[model samples]
Target: MASSAQPYHFGFKKSKNGELPSIAQEGFMNILQKNGSIFLGDAGQKELYLTFDNGYENGYTAKVLDVLKAKKVPAAFFVTGHFVRDQPELLRRMNDEGHIIGNHSWSHPDMTSLTPEQIRTELDKVREASARITGQQKMSFVRPPRGIFSSRVLETCKQLGYTNVFWSAAYRDWETDRQQGAGYAYQQVMSQLHPGAVILLHSVSKDNAEALSSIIDDARKQGYTFKSLDELKVKMYR
Candidate 1:
């Protein structure tokens, strides 16, 4: 999108002469510009955007798909080249079922640590694979691996015609052993949810698959409808 009309504002540490410290000024500006709010369409409308990352063919994806299909809900799936190549059918199913498929980089490297060329390669590899499998060029959304991104990464995504999507809400269900439980994860997600909240879940989590439908149900009960990132016309901060 559109750039947010909201003015950039932040608290800053001042120097002895009352001027802002250089580092603090830069940090504050970055925060203010990068921290745009996620809008879920109209005001007073409770909408939740569900997104999944690092999808591989664990067969749990199918179960997750089943639940979404049953509920007539759509979600966004960020896939790597490896997953797309290994599970072409599942990728196809995701596309065919009307879910948004997004790039999550080829090897899920920490983009901030990679060279600009390496980052481009990571994005290009995933874009090429996703296009090959889905016959669609120009995937418009991406989430950095581990939610790590630099200014260079964000600029790279913009140059590649992809929007960098990050979540407003997430939990520790990515770790299989540390997942607390499905019910608890579900409760954590739903409880913290708000309008325009992008809830990040991992497709690889067994607890997540178990909690998926219930989370959707409970979010609905609380009057939050779900939307894909593509459907959300959020103002870009940078």
Candidate 2:
């Protein structure tokens, strides 16, 4: 089934007053369901999925990996073609250390604006490039660049054998120069804790790198288990 070309920027109301964040307002949930995409897991279970967008190396991913390793957490790193080309060792290490390497598109363009074939090229290039280095032949998950997508983009991803992964929790941690310190990052993440949350973080943020260890530790203390994307089971909410 084909859908409209209209683009949607992914977003949701942040959880507050001890509530799960809602993506219900904009038909985000509906579209995701229609396109076989996923933004949340089973809300009945206290499981959290950690994912990072690594468009380029800002010199913090190694530290992020270190923290994940030290804490025994498995996270997914959605990388762009540039990241694969520039940081082969990091990619290899991520795979070796038991992390899923995902696709964030080749040029990090708005996939909604590209044709299906163009979209395929963008995704294939990253997958092939990544496989060569990481030796993990199957790159199955994709997060669109800048959280922008449409029905067409989602369908293209499915046709190309990818599951589009959106997030249920995120904050403005992408602005590298305006970092508000690790405590602020910690607070932003901690406040949004809920069952089946897909947390999106940018590896370039120094705040995320600094706060990640605490985030994992405290979440576990609260009884939230961090699971790999492979273990994720999509749950549809109406």
Candidate 3:
């Protein structure tokens, strides 16, 4: 594999009317496919994967967990070292409730700029800390900070025994201060709903916390089943 130091920002054309989103960068898509990374699941199936980036505590993860528990939905939470240190109890709750704990690096740095060994250290620190807290010895999934990655970054992670998980559906919900409302979050997510969407949400968003239950309900009403990333069946685009 070629070690291209260039960073690729993950983005896709928003899906509408249940259409599959398209990635604009062919080279980046190739890198993802070659590395066995995934941003979507089987497009032919009406299944959605929910994941959250927990970079820090925003006082809403508990609510999120509550909703997931009530709705019986499984989600993956990618946590950074800061999150692991700051919210051990929350990590334990997530683990205890049968959710997937994924690595989001130690310091949440642009991993494309780091050396392979440096990346290993960053990921290892998070995994080790999380394992101590959650008693899960293996952390198999990773999402690069800020959706930025390179072939070298992905390759390094692959060699380290991780699957890079990206997102096929997302919105600007991370800006907590600018939260529109729960309705806004619901609209943004529902409008982009499609089969095989790997929806990326931020646990810091109050709107997401409020709208999550409704999102799950409406997605289910639309005949879409919620699935964990572990059950994902990859479908590559041309």
- In model 2, which runs have C-alpha deviations exceeding 4 angstroms? 1-3
- Candidate 3, residues 131-181: lDDT per residue as tens digits? 998889999899999999998999999999999999988999999789999
Per-model TM-score versus the true fold: 0.81, 0.97, 0.97
C-alpha lDDT values of all predictions: 0.71, 0.90, 0.93
Best model per lDDT:
3
Error of 1 at 176 (Å): 1.8
lDDT string, candidate 2, 1-238, tens digits: 4356779999887876447777888666777888778788878889999999999999999999999999999999999999999999999999999999999999999888999999999999999999899778889999999999998898889988899999888999999999999999999999998898889999999999999999999999999999998898766453
- Which of 1 and 2 is the better model by TM-score? 2
TM-score attained by model 1: 0.81
Q: Tell me which residue pairs clash in candidate 2.
A: none
- Regions more than 4 Å wrong, model 3: 1-3
Error of 1 at 199 (Å): 0.6
| TM-score rank order | 3, 2, 1
How do the residues 3-81 of candidate 1 rate in per-residue lDDT, one tens digit apiece? Answer: 3222222222222221112223433235323533231223234667888886566658999999999999999999987
Candidate that beats the other on lDDT, 1 or 3, i.e. the better one: 3
